[model samples]
Target: MKAYLDLLQDVYDNGVGKDDRTGTGTRSVFGRQLRCNLSEGFPLLTTKKVFLRGIIHELLWFVRGDTNIKYLVDNNVGIWNEWPFQNYLNAQDLGNLEKHSCEWEERLDAFVIRIQKDQDFAAKWGELGPVYGKQWRNFSGIDQLDWVINEIKQNPTSRRLIVSAWNPAEIEEMAKAGLPPCHTLFQFYVSHDNKLSCQLYQRSADLFLGVPFNIASYALLTMMVAQVCDLELGDFVHTYGDVHIYNNHENQVLEQLSRAPKSLPTMSINPNVKSLFDFTFEDFELLNYQPESAIKAPVAV
Candidate 1:
């Protein structure tokens, strides 16, 4: 976790401030890499308590190719609530807005309630378009996840074991993808000793609020793949492009960095789950996750 802390400090010290798609500005840097050896520990952050439930749900959601947030919402995972809610708010006419004097905070609450209670509303508003899940499981009618898993098993040494979430065609049509994939692509490598290693190429990283979740999500993914393939856990290499800390989250970042990293936790998966797609939320568990405390920060939707 020191590597993650170093990244925060590095960005604050050496990064250049820049405007982003979200109005919140950022201190940005390009082309940085962080690696964690899985054998050492699970590599979950020890400085601040990460919401492991949300991380697990999001990864499972991606594996299922679920482009909707209804599953996440039902399971109490709200990490993705902002994007669809913003879209819904943008659709309302200004005349109606002025007449009602819309309270966005209240409407946001109602948005979740409606999604939970109304099936039609959930279908219409819960969808996140072709985000990670859609891209991972079915990219242009191809099952990339299944293909990659098979490649790892049959041809472990093949350099082509990759899953790409960045669909240029979908990005061009912005309506399909509300937001482009940030963790764009990931590649898997099998060493001679049958240890599985993964390297992720993230095009844009939200260092404060999102990077921690990204690291755990991909690390879990790597472990799951390795488990099904019957290989030893190796390194998780996280490479980034345009990693940045949002202006609003600077204080939280520093506060988190101030704390000393505790011992890394260990994660275990149900041995019965031999296939990657067969994993349910119950199949994964984090052990010894004592951390400092949760740091609160506003997300830049």
Candidate 2:
């Protein structure tokens, strides 16, 4: 995890300041990469405790071809709550309220409550339009995920095992109710040693909050695909484009950096599951993940 911490520090020390679409400024860098060996240990951030349950549930939701926040909110994962809430507030002409204000937070909390309890309201307002799940499973009517899994099984030597979530045609629609995909495209490579490796090209990365989950999610995805394909675990290489730390998160980042990283955790997946799409939340467990307290940071919506 030193590599992860080093990148955070590098961005902090060397990045250029840039304004973002969310109206929050950032210290931005370009073209950084992180690689983690799956066999070594799960590359979850140790400097601060990450919500593994949310990551697992979100990834599972992606694989399930779901684009709604209801499943996440129902599972008590609030990571995607801010985006939809902001869009709703704006669409409802309530954008006059300051976004970071107490009233705004209260309204957002109420919004999540509606999404959690009212299925009709959730179906109407909670749809994150054609985000990762929709693009991964049905990018222009192609099931990229299923296709990639089958391709890995049938033609491991083929170099075209790629899945992309960046549909330029639908980018505007996605941004209307949700966010553009940051972890954009990924390709899988099979080594002669019967190991499966994945490399993700993320178009944009929120280093402090998003990158940790991106690393863990792709690593877990690789592990799941490898299990279903009967191959050994390999490396997950994350390639980023516009990677940045939000300006407001700088203090939290420093707090995180001040802490020493503990040992990596081992993720145990149910070996009996031979299908990637068949994985459920109970099928996975993170063992020995002792880390420091959580450092809260606001999402730049």
Candidate 3:
């Protein structure tokens, strides 16, 4: 966790301030990386409370080959809520109201209500739309998960066990609709000694609001993959493109850096679950996670 704290502090001390899409401003840096050894313990942030349930459920959703927000919303996870909600707002007929007005909150609330009312809105808003699951499960004509499994069984030494989330065709569609993928790609490495390592390549990382969850999510994924492949968990590496500290979350990030981390939390996966795809949310446990108070930060959607 000191490693995590160091990265935040480094960004604050050296990052360049710039205006961003949300108009909330940002202190941004390029090409930062973080690595955690899963053999030690789960690399969940201990300086501030993180939403473990949300992380678990979101990972489960991705593994389930689900491309919908209903599972997330139903389970009280609000991580992906902003993207679909914002997309919905962008598509709405606002009737002379400014798009980025203070009424945005009210409009978003109404949009959620409308999604609950209209089946079509639910179908649209609930859909994940070319997110991690689609790419991991079915990337164009290539099934990444199957290929990874086959490689592990047959080769066990190939560096090609990679899952790419950045589809040029899908990016074109999302960009045309005014949405772009953030966490772009990921690659996995297998050691000769049968240690599984995962490296995530995030094209855009919202440090304050998104990085913590991203770290936990991918670490969990690495552990799961390692378990399925009967390999020891190695390092979870995070490679960022444009990592930014949101203006509103500056104080919170600073506070987190000042706090000393507690012991790393132990994540217990069901020993019987031998396949990554066979894991359910019930097959996981978090142990000895004691952290300080959560510092609420507004998401710049």
Candidate 4:
């Protein structure tokens, strides 16, 4: 994972400070790229332990065509609670939420519990409108995931194997929708040796908190496609625009860079899962994962 560490350092050294929508301020760079070889190892960050369970559940949820956070909360994944909680807080007309206060924290906790225990509340506030799953499964009444898989098998040499989450018509609505796609689009390439490779284009990347999960998520996606297509795994290329580290996480970023990365972990998937939509959270496992303690950092909403 030297590539990841290097990117972090690069942003620190050369990026310009700018204010963002979250008002966290960042030292950000534009247009950077990183590639991971799937044959080497799973590209999970070993410097700071990542929550693999959350990654697995979130990815599976997206594939299930679920736009609600109920599935994630039920499976103990709270990575996405901040946005919906913010929406609820806004509806309540709370002011000066620049930094979440003790009262705000308490209310957010109650709100999550309500989403878990109350189905109606979950339906009302837990849904991220037209987000990743909705876009992937029902973009303009077309299932891009199904189309891509069939294209890879039917015409391996075709260059049109792509799935996009960026709908221009919905961009204005997403501005206030509390959620938008960051990993915007991805394209697949098939090699002469029957290997499948994928490249993702992310519009805005949070280097410290989000990039690691993005890497693992897409790598797993590539592996699943390769498995169902009877092909070998190749590379996972990550391209970014406006990649930045939140100013508050400066210390944690340095701490992570100071630690030497351990050996990359391997992932095993159930061989019986023949379809992309058939994958469940239980069908995935991370093997030989030994890492340093997880570094705690605040997420920029």
The residue ranges of model 1 lying beyond 4 angstroms of the native Cα positions read 94-102, 174-177
lDDT of 2 by residue, 42-111 (tens): 9998889899999999999999999999999999999998888887888889977897789998998899
Better of 1 and 3 by lDDT: 1
lDDT order, best first, reads 2, 4, 1, 3
Superior candidate under lDDT, 1 versus 2: 2
**lDDT, residue 99, model 2:** 78
Local distance difference test values of all predictions, in order: 0.89, 0.94, 0.81, 0.91
When sorted by TM-score, best at the front, the candidate numbers are 2, 4, 1, 3
Of candidates 3 and 2, the better by lDDT: 2
Q: Tell me the deviation in Å of residue 196 in model 1.
A: 0.3
Give candidate 4's error at residue 187 in angstroms: 0.5
Worst 10 residues of 4 by lDDT: 171-180
Task: Give the per-residue lDDT digits (tens) of candidate 1, residues 232-268.
Answer: 9999999999999999898998898789898999999
Model 4: per-residue Cα lDDT over 146-174, one tens digit each: 99999999999999999998988776655
lDDT over C-alpha atoms for residue 141 of model 4? 98
Error of 2 at 255 (Å): 1.4
lDDT of 3: 0.81
Clashing pairs in 3: none
